[model samples]
Target chain A: MLNAQVEPYQRLRENLSQRDRSLREKVMTLEEAASFVQDGMKVGIGGSTMSRTPMAMIWELVRQRRKNLSCSRAITSTDGDILFGSGVSDHIITSWFAQGILWGLSKVMRRHVEQGLARYEEWSHMAVGMRFRAGGMGVPFLPIRSMLGSDVMDQRPEAKQIDCPFTGEKLLLVPALNPDVALIHVQRCDAYGNAQIDGLQFMDIDLALAANRVILTTERIVSNDQIRRAPDQTKIPFFCVDAVVEVPYGSAPHECFGIYEPMLNHMEAYVAKVNSDPVEGMREYLERYFYEPKSWNEYLALIGMEEVLDASQKGRSIYND
Target chain B: MTDTTRYTAAEILAILSARQLKDGQVVFAGVGTPLLAATLAQRLRCPGLTILFEGGVVGAFVEPGKLPPSTNDQRCTKRANMVLGSADVLLLLQRGYVDIGFMGGAQIDQFGNLNSSFIGDPAAPKTRLPGTGGGNDISSLTNMIVAMKHEKRRFVEKVDFITSPGFIRGGTSRAESGLPAGGMFRVITELAIFGFDEKTRRMKVLALNPGVSRENVQDNTGFDLVFDEQIAITEPPTEHELETLRSIDPERMFI
Candidate 1:
């Protein structure tokens, strides 16, 4: 029999800090925040494909050689490739994983998945969000119409077919996906972890509430007064976040909304190299980008400031006053 | 050099897909050709058409000479629009708010089933595709316009996997399956335009492009295709359509 007093959700709620917690500064180093991710944990990544990806933290995990992690995102991009390539994550659950539309598929992913080096658990885009919603709400599962008759339903045993009790219509039920930790990047947030996301919040809100712990990486740690001035904008509260690290351009290479766009030249270079030789090329990329670089700043230096400046101008220009 | 008079294979596909859209229909566009085709529709023909990205961008005007590399890119959200959560936009499909699901897949069958997951066997596949993003949800809840090149290897008797379901086993099956909104409406290709027969759910050629013979259509397709009683000739892309499409992509990144 299940214990009524010790429900998993009740326990999780208790872990979420009380009133004074929001007042306390949650700032920490990137290394310290990333250390919360242990081997073989189910981690949630914020942002959609090629936009607002928490790449710096992922690189940190790779540098730390964190292995066997099961990661999930609403949609994935080169970050997923880095996770698989670095062996930081063995299992990746998501809706999609292409680098981009024009570039087509990721050769790094193709080589690893086809060769049986990693595990890929696929779900429809809506289904992934609804599953996270179910987790956040502390429900066992949520019913939706996605993958009703498609082979995608057959691939996922977790999703069940059920006749709607009210309307007698067929529906598919997807189970809750509660990750152990969530890595998110925002445009700006206070040291107290009052974070605000600028662009389309692709499922980060659901992921934040569902995950047991949240590691927030921000472009800059603004003052609490600044966050309070725009109280309505704070999407991630300090009560849910355990660590906050200010890593400017945290989502570099990948586009960071209101900050910079995708560094196409760098991405093209990466794609070309990886396509030429998936295995050896991937290893070299890791060594050059992840391993050899002493710090995140050094990696930025390698990418060159000119590319960053150009991307910044273009990305910021997209937003008209 | 940029060629405006001559259209490439991708250009023609974009043009045909654009022509299929009406004036003010909200389209759920996927990445690559679908996005380009939908944007071309908004620009050249239907200015009132609303292009929706799976990443939750709605009603944004794509700027000239700056096509987004992906659906979620900043370029996809250039003009005035409301940006909601990704879940918020896809949930509209359940409410019958979206009109078209424009996308392309790795393989498609006579029944309109799509395979975007893998090429070979499930256990051991030759090529591993990016799993269905909003492919299934889009096709399941709204009318789909599948655009792809006509090739024997692509148009198969049966898909390797059904990443998105169309008509299941034919007549009335999609409706019977409890999907409230829509089904496969049209299939656009470089060589011809086809539609699913209401009774049989089989892919049938409605029109052939200029210089494309019936034999060319049959020989290029993997399976036997049904020909409509009145097969029409598809008009070639006009100079304006070709020029505008080229201007959209001066570098020919996608054209």
Candidate 2:
């Protein structure tokens, strides 16, 4: 029989032990996490135009020649189209692409639809409103009047059309998006996986709630007690988290606060190279970054911090001291 | 006061420049002519006006003379208070926070319907340009909307696609649609300044540009260009307005 007097302390110790074990088992390298994403899986990414994204893992997936491993259904607020253009994704459900700079990226997406390589579903910003509302309400679907007479309805036949018995106005039904997995990057997390997103709260909050499982890559891992000390900032509670990988400079080439400056030169070079020779450029990138890495540290070493710093100084807008 | 008869871009600048602007006034600026007008309004007219770009930069400031290609131009980020996602901007508009919206269309009918979606045919088009880029929302919501375009075939008898609802058939349906009252108040063009009729809401030419005759304006337009009995030439730019507009944008005179 357990002693009642020591039960609370014993429970605390057990919780700590479980957290420690999970942290020990967390995948440190991008390649390891990339491997977890299988072929023909619908994936949800967390980002918007020129903001937070899991670029490292995406780059690794391309490098490893992870063929036949395509996202069956891809969803993002923005920037995911850039990934799709890089030959990473097949199908997509999104609003707009690059906000107009890369005009006809949507045209390319249409070509993919024409060739039957993938299916494309164009959503308005209203769809985002409906999805978030459904996720927050824990409902299966939400009714909205946005796509009533628009071409969006014809594109998404799966969306149920219902007549408003009261007004007789047609409303397009958007399905609740419960993603198979949500991969997010945050500023800080605890050993037990309670995460805090310091800067702009894009769609991370809703994404965390809507996804079936959450995998987080964070800048630092602290004690659970530290997170509890300041509960207001802890956006994602540990209960919802499936795994927490503490990767310093994890949002590298993308700004993660108190970590590293963004790799803007790298991003620009990537955009230019991809625009010039997409297939060959990606192949060269894979050979240079992934296959050549003897280990994770070797991979990290190849991206020199000094080079990033220099690039930042030379007119690249990266957050650094 | 007597010099209020010679029209120029600077005089047009003065009309927007005299208005008092509060902080956080969401100004949605369209491309080309409206871009100049809005930029001048911000720089010379109202410094506190928060310019919201269709490409998603909120409260962006242009560096003295540079006009960006689009709202998402890199310079826009460099000179912005905050860069919001396009989706977020649309959300803000839906909530009715946008104060003023500016738009231009290829064809605007007597009913205030704009056509920018297609050119020749819906099924098969001769020249299919970029369809409506958020003009639908911009024309619908903001407290007041300003329409600017060079009056021509682009400004036609009837638009091919109703990309935006201007006066939407008439005032009754427009008000019923929950659009703000005083719908589509003004239409500014290279040749004239027109206002919607009180009862019909059809565009009535109020003033003409200097050196532009009624016949020239009518000849260029596909529809019957309405005119007022007392239609006068617009006032020319003052030294202050001209200097300010020129200083802000030296390359083009959007008047």
Candidate 3:
């Protein structure tokens, strides 16, 4: 369906002198990215646990009060928890819940699941990755050796046990998952969306390709020359990205690897807030941070850019060499 | 003040768990107490131990002072080895590349079956726990060592759900179920160390922790235990092991 068609929805980055039609034509504001998300849409999010999560887009979705989203990711932390807490997401398909900087259950997610406010389908981390891989490869299913002889096979409806065609060995088959839209945050990206992911790539590439649309939220927007300087660092190409939004400290409270350490104090405060009056505290938190800030710059300013600078400097110390 | 002489029950459990690790073996560790025990092993006795986090971090050299918040923590990939996607690391476990799979569970049965999935029925559950990440794959493929405190509530006749694959119904059932060969199951708790019988696959007590009598282990266990005739008293943590373990987790969050 993606023929040589250049739809009007494809808006190129503004202020660029050389206007190559082939140059990525989908650079939008975060609001525009979240607007594409309709009620009851299955949205795939890419990140490894808390690190490099698309917290900016997640907050934007929460701010817009998008409802009935089916959140899909392999390792979800604060991003998923916030979506569930804000009552924006009703269903989650994930392998595991990576709690905030302190490793434990996300109390919000736990309460939702236990209280039947939300539902979940569990998979092994690998199983979900394989599902994304199969989706990207345009395959029906991927064979794996996980969840065999365990209750995960019985628990997850999408997981099936089938004998290998070649060896007749029993292997678990995970069905392909194609998300309507993928919200991914990366370390750096050009205006055209040549993204670079530092540290662990996780399943970002697979999720990006598997989704019908990719909404790339980047930590910073760099020059095309910088992207070309290190082509090997690029994980997602321009064609795979449908929209690009520049969100500095986009994965706050969760580190962006070579950029910053996770803000543990912020995470602890979030836990404390949820612990004391889960409903009112969450609403106040959303109002104070997400609704109050007109722009990401305002949010960063409230969080103290000095701390961000310090964290960025600290993280750069070990990786800058 | 750091006490050099005595250690807490959790510290004692961690020390016992750490002692099970070999020097040069690769271990697949889950989060929380399992991570704590593996870190303690790396620091104290088994310096060459390579830790594998479920987030695809391999051969992580866990340094002291900062406890990794989760398996996906960037610290998990610090300093050494390769960072792979989550699928590739679990693939290694399936290939039998890992030696030991260290795990902790909410509930464990006499047959070594673990439950971290849910506390009640799957349909309309009472308590829904986070489902298995790679726990089942690790347990099925590697030599499984369980680390937890000895409590009547945690140890049961049968788990609410078997999140990790153990010897299914005893004798030859795991192999019969098409699970790949390699890896036996062992249980390491605060009060005792137990290993499954070769034939029956039933948990048998090998040693009891100091100050914990034979009756204490029996009282805490939900199922009947088979005690070895020459069951030895588990050695208390040395001054150095205790100091190093406490130093590793000075906050005592997991310990």
DockQ of each: 0.77, 0.14, 0.56
Question: Lowest lDDT 10-mer window, candidate 3 chain B?
Answer: B1-10
Tens digits of per-residue lDDT for model 1, B138-217: 99999999999788999999888889888876777777776767889999988899999979999999999877888899
Sorted by DockQ, highest first, which candidate order results? 1, 3, 2
**Residue pairs in candidate 1 whose N, alpha carbon or C atoms collide under 3 angstroms:** none
Q: Which CAPRI level is candidate 1?
A: medium
Residue lDDT tens for model 3, B1-255: 112358777788788888999999999998777888898988877878999998778888765666767787677776658888777788898788888999887788877888877888977677777677777778777789888877898989888887887886778877766686654567888788999998998889998888777888898889999998999987788989988888888887677
Which run of 10 residues does model 2 chain B get worst, by summed lDDT?
A: B13-22
What digit string (tens of lDDT, one per residue) describes model 2 on residues A221-265? Answer: 887778889999888777656667766555545544334444555
* TM-score of the A-chain for all models: 0.94, 0.74, 0.89
Worst 10 residues of 3 chain A by lDDT: A3-12
Q: Which candidate leads in TM-score?
A: 1
Arrange candidates, best lDDT first. Answer: 1, 3, 2
- Which residue ranges in model 2 land beyond 4 Å of their true spot? A1-28, A64-78, A99-119, A158-173, A222-226, A246-307, A310-321, B1-43, B47-92, B95-97, B102-140, B143-255
Q: Give the lDDT of residue B110 in candidate 1.
A: 91
User: What TM-score does the first chain of candidate 2 have?
Assistant: 0.74
